[model samples]
Target: MAKYVAPAISLSPFTCPACGAYAQQIWAHAIYVQPHANTNYDVAPLRRCKCASCQAYSFWSKETEAQIFPRAVASPMPHPDLPENCAAVYLEARNVVGDSSKAAAALLRLCVQHLLVHLGGKGKNLDDDIAKLVKEGLAVQVKDALDICRVVGNNAVHPGEINLDDDPAMAGQLFELINFIVRETIERQKRLAEMVDRLPQGARDAIAKRDAKALNGLA
Candidate 1:
């Protein structure tokens, strides 16, 4: 799936959030009037656009410049290498971010929890699972990223600790973190292993012997 890229201006070409296609947008003002004392007063300025590729429409307030239709905020595409289940939930969270950031955050937290299990973490408490992975040598940056999602997600579920609605941007960050974790923990390792597998058998055997001797020496 194509990653979402917000348009610099409403009329500018951009990746369609609905269709994930980069295309030009045709823009027009949507006028609405209210009758008061026999005089019609225009309401807030509204703008609408149609994607050239998908022909899908998006509406936004000219004053606020916020998307009103398809309430979901633009979210980065899920990493191409994410596991199927994790990717599904990630997209689910993305679809609802504008409607309820808290709900989206909660869903992302679940995605992280599932991802940990897929990464061989014990399917237990989220906090414990994260700690276990950190103990097992997860990169410091990845551990910090995981904790950000874990903490925000907990706050979203329990409420009162942090107001997600007040800070939708933080929820957006979680999506990026999810992809980052996958790239670091899963994609990077897979690429390295594939590269190692491509080495000549004789070289691979020699490397294995070298590691074995190092381990024996450590013993």
Candidate 2:
């Protein structure tokens, strides 16, 4: 059996798996001392933490067992060279529509979604960003030029009355969607190459000179 103890003091805090993003910046407290013989309690009182980027609360002990472990560290922002991982999710959503014609919009959705997923550069809220792209970006322009076919991507998964084959508006939306994605992808890719200057000096010179060898080993 375990013995009962009296109220105790808490001390300075470390990064909370729970909080970092508040405007004021507070830490979720970590307990350094505990009752000597208590076996029933798995964790201490809840403390608030904020997401450093979005300023969301970081709840303590959401993963109780996970609290005791280590996770591999990776860069906060994924390299610009690897935006394809971002594109993959959009492609996945495209497949959900089950039409080749949908590819263009699917690609666009992927771009918007990609930007959203990486909104913070830490690559957080990307899903939220995708949501905004659909709701704010695509849906906003529906009556004007964007059309609403792309809404099927969002609607099909939810309480929407639209279907892919039955709706031409959806088709038009898909067209606009594709154009958006392709333009953004090309721009970002170009921007990344410029930023990194990743190509060899000869490769850069070749591209500058319209050299066919810039096609990568194409003789």
Q: Estimate each model's TM-score.
A: 0.73, 0.29
> In model 1, where do residues sit more than 4 Å from their true spots?
1-4, 8-14, 19-72, 213-219
Estimate every model's Cα lDDT from 0 to 1.
Answer: 0.84, 0.41
Across 1-219, the per-residue lDDT of candidate 1 in tens digits comes to 354577644657787778767788998776555555555444447777889998998888887888878663568778878889988999999988878899899999999989999887875788899888878888999999999999999999996678887898899899999999988989899999999999999999999999999999999
Please name the candidate that would achieve the greatest lDDT relative to the true structure: 1
lDDT by residue (tens digit), candidate 2, 1-219: 011121112212322222211133355554444568554433465444443545544434443422222221111111223257655544444344334434434454444445544333223444444455565444343222322333554454444576544653464355334434444544555788787597788878767777555555675
Model 2: weakest 10-residue lDDT segment is 1-10
TM-score of 2: 0.29
Using TM-score as the measure, the top candidate is 1
